[model samples]
Target: MIKKFTLFLLLVLPISAFAQRFSQYFSSTMVESFENPAQGIFKPDTTKMMAFNFFVPNLSASAYTTGNATTTLKQYLFLHNSTFPNIYVGRNNFNTLSTNNNIYVGMFKMFADLAGKQEIGFSWQIRAEGTAHFTDETVQLFDGGTNFNNLQPYTNLFNDRYYAQGYHQFSFTYRETLSPKFSVGYKISALSGIAYDNTTINQSDIIFNKNQSDGTSALYLNLIGQHRTSYTPGSFAANNVVPNFKNPGLSVSFGVEQHNEDGVHIQYNIKDLGFIHWGSDPHIYNFNHTDTIGLSSGNAGQNVYNGASFITQQGGENKSFTTVTNGLAEISATKYFWLDGEKQFKYNPILVASKQLFYNGIAGAFINNVQYGKVTVGVMGTYDDLKQFNLGGKIMFKSANAEVFLGTEQLLTSYDMFRAHRGNLNYINSNANFTGAGIFFGFALKFGADVESPANASSIPMGEDEGFLKRTFKNIFGKKPKDYINSPGATSP
Candidate 1:
């Protein structure tokens, strides 16, 4: 039984495709000095500056099968239980659910000037970013069979499956100022690790057989097997499997900021220009090709072909496959202006154009301002390949010296054709419409005061007596002081 199951796993494993989507958070934002090379511009005033930021996002979707062909949901169910029956499944029906969550923490400090210029400041920044995803699926069989009779006499069969993935990254950035209004920065990052766990449970009495006479018979066996078995939860448990996953990559960026005499400030940056490859390589598996003939009760002697064949049965036949690498790139710019000279009231409306250099492109904008001294508001819009267009807004309040940003992104594009295809299936098909959208919310806070500017040098002072004596000696000589001094100090006069 173990060997048969192992063979089954090997056969179906290559059929599953895993594609990691680019993060919207990473896409919509501009590249910081840490990720770009043109970091030798704009300087932040850290003399009394402190900041904090946070982001949260959620996405949910479903779709009906296109035409009569098997959808991703159906394929998943069929792979797990080859004998399960298919029923009507639509956009409202959810055979699988996947959720992703992320959190980010950033902090920095600036001190000490380089090259004897107060305009040149150095700072150290650390960023801690984490991501977690949970996927739950429930597959149901439409076939009426006793093979799943353990749960019910002769009715519906269902299975519940769960999957989880998590990872974290810690990075450090160094920023240096080149001018009073411009600075450049670079960041070196190392990913500590990553992990993925998946679990599948057959709630019905369905059993999968390497050899089954018909579809109905296969479904019945799968149902019966599921009813007789119990699965334990945890990584690598008898019922759970964990895949080896890790991400290693380098990121470089450059940014520039300029403040005109009119107090109009603009900033631009490019970021995340790197790639991450999963450790797993691609391979093809051969399914058993033997056919089984009937061994009916009346027919005592009948040849049956179970379609069983060895991997080399077809004269070393092999299939080719390759794994896809995941990577991202982005460019963004923003403009800020003060509504008041005192800088108490500031209007920062920014336009951003960004693209995943390797995967996708997105463009958006945001407007932020302070009203009532403690409240802030922002509105944003973005276009995505899967969700066409998205519109959302956020409101924030400062309390206890902490600031929070609460807003949604891609709200309008969640139900488009793009979302239906990619979100439902792990694979990207050319025929699939790619306009899908997702939403996210983020927060940032400021802490500590900006550092003080360096002290200025004072002019040198001379004694009044020296000035008076020089004037008196010049008058007595009736000539220029230079001539008197050159004449041996007026001959001891």
Candidate 2:
């Protein structure tokens, strides 16, 4: 009965979910600048020459889950699968799943020059990235032993993988405006790799032969290119809590923006095109095997590499390797519309297309942004390569010297879950699975006088008329939003 419930959940549940990637788009705080260095120069905050931001510990995270079966928090934590009826296993059924977590704390050390003709910015940060993937056949083999049904031949079914890394980055950015309509910017980063691990099953073919009368079974298998790396065993007695930064890497980012006199703007950004080179100390192993196992043989012992048994045979090597970092590329277009005669309320529609190159996911979204005075609110509808549609929202408050914001990608899912939980209804619906959710929030402090002499510098007057975007910059840098009309040489839309 437990097995039947597992199978039911696997076959019936919606299979895709991810974190709030779109929240950063409408987030107007200084912390958002770290996501893309080009944003550091956006609109040029003239009042702030320096800024600092800290992600409250355990408050910043991004995670995603993909699988053949979906499980809810209630079912996973409380319910017993044995309460269900007879199990039905589908033929030609193969399930593959992956979950990734990136826990990061950005001490957004940022510096900028707003009054200069050529804008310059710099930042340093630390990040920890981790990922894991597994296939249903791999789990079945572990749970049921040699009990696989002999109805069909299994080929390329051992699809499992994992990767984890920690690193620090120092980024330097520069931007220059060639004309009122066009500007270009670029950022280069030096990456200091702290630790790394990766594992994957490249290929597999297996067949099970079961004797009908005696209930005996034999297995024929061919598996190849199972690769892994580890740093905590044998000669590498590394620390359990501290990071090791013996490896290093480099990356570069570039962006371009085009804005018109009519308040229509387009921007593009390509980030983190780089690779990391691991050291020789970490054990890199590769395995390949072809063998037959009888039921009485008790199966060959596993644990090939990383001290975990992944193949029928332990076949691999120990060495060094290099891997490319998963980077991001995105493009967006935004246009502002006046909502009132006083220009105190405005509406902006935005379109963004983005890709995660390594994870192999593409996403597109349409966002509506509404700004009234120092507050901004946004709603977005997004679709990703996972075939998942998501709704997201964001709210922000900004002043001349400080800003704070919070947002989420699964607003609808969260709301529905709350309502269902209150009414005592089954939270797991048939159409959609809410396996994961995340929220992002942070505060920043920007302080620097616009003039060389501190005595001559005064806070920006509140009565000036400035566009919403410019007001955002001013508020971020400690300047008040204004109602300026057609300021001279104004480049931002």
Candidate 3:
């Protein structure tokens, strides 16, 4: 029964989820520039004035599910078996699922000017984020009391939280080089919400009592906390998934890049630091702890959820609330060296450290790339504070006029999943640690006139152009003298 419920949830989601690909850093792809904010993507004479994906998606997707339930996931999702899953319950066993999805439906950029190497872009993206946290007993309660001992009480087994959201983002970005060693950029976005759902059980307990009449059991469940959703349960229609201003929000991202005196390039970025206010009319459920339900012979587990909702019918109709986006802060250092004597082959390495803004977690990664002319290949490894480790690689074909890249950022997890589906997977101690799978791919094209400094180009006139952000800054704070490193014509001043 737990297998069927979980499978239904997974099937309702998009086939591909998203994860960050560290190898894309310094690759000069459009997604990289948009993600990092301050990274430059144009060559003075080689790149075109305009670049776009031409409606082709520049997408990155990956996901991970950790904890003991994954063994059962391996069975239903992989082995295609009919075995009833047995979860480790009443012993504080737990499981978690984390996933993200980013799809760039449209992206367009052009070299706006030369001062500070200024560039501007416009983009439209559809994104989704989610996480699920639950104990093994939580699953056991849903399908029946097969894993529970009658006359015994399980404490806090129903404590869990599940939240998922998707939205559309329209953004405008600007980035400029302050000097050869310094650059800064920013992105401002307006978000239109598509869907939102969250449920939490902060404190809960359950007891199974033997039923003498039908040989089944009676469930005495005490539940606390609340549930929130934008639509009625089992009534999420096609229109509910469409973008509407009924729920609107905003977000911003910024990044800074610098070249240190030691020949290393350092970059710092803060992404998606904002929140969304859901529609005014939303369903909210606050659970009360006094509900005793009778378990049927077959569908006992699913009835638990129905019983919880029934207990909250009085408070389920309420106003909406606000939620913060998953924000990130990260720093990385990069250095390159010529691999051969002739200098035709170049090798670059980058080390990165990232933090979750709203949570207590961090991840560190190493990326190594070798470039020969227009082709490049690289490998990467990352470990998080939670002890999760991932290994992946990338291959790219990039020239001044175009770029294309594809790779698995979670190769080990993908391989493990593949092997499990083939019915030949094993763990050293019945523990797979973490299980996941994903891939990232993107392509972009460049055309039109050559991108050049507006002050030096015959096709562009400085008198006809002034940056929107620059003008706005001066208008709000008054004009100021330019710094030595910020002047357009002062290369060595």
Task: Judging by lDDT against the true structure, name the best candidate.
Answer: 3
Off by over 4 Å in 2: 1-19, 26-28, 40-46, 54-60, 72-74, 77-119, 128-133, 139-155, 205-223, 230-244, 289-313, 414-425, 428-434, 450-493
Q: Rank the candidates by TM-score, best first.
A: 3, 2, 1
Estimated TM-score for each candidate: 0.45, 0.71, 0.88
What global local distance difference test value does model 3 have?
A: 0.75
- Badly placed stretches (over 4 Å) of model 1 are 1-100, 105-166, 196-249, 258-266, 275-327, 337-345, 366-372, 398-402, 410-450, 455-493
Query: Which sections of candidate 3 miss by over 4 Å?
Result: 8-18, 79-86, 289-298, 308-314, 422-430, 453-493
Residue 68 local lDDT, model 3: 73
lDDT tens digits by residue: candidate 2, 1-493: 2233333223222122235455555343555455544444233434455555655531344333434433322232234221111112333233333233333344443333223224555666555454555554554452333345654777776655555665667677665543456555677878777656666767877777666366765566666665545353433343522443566788788876777777877778887778777764556556676666454332322211211333522655556677666677888888888899999998878888888767666888888889898788888888877676778888877765677777766677556545544553455432333344446666776665442222343544334333334445567765432222235554343
> Candidate 1 lDDT (Cα, whole model)?
0.33
User: Candidate 2 at residue 4, lDDT?
Assistant: 37
Worst 10 residues of 2 by lDDT: 80-89
A best-first ranking of the candidates according to their lDDT comes to: 3, 2, 1
Clashing pairs in 3: 17-61, 17-62, 18-61, 18-62, 18-100, 19-62, 116-177, 142-301, 143-301
For candidate 3, write residues 78-99 as lDDT tens digits: 5543233447766777777676
lDDT-wise, the better of 1 and 2 is 2
Model 3 vs. true fold: TM: 0.88
lDDT of 1 by residue, 128-215 (tens): 1211111111222221222223433222223333333333334455454444454444455443223332333332232333245553
- Output the lDDT of residue 221, model 2: 66
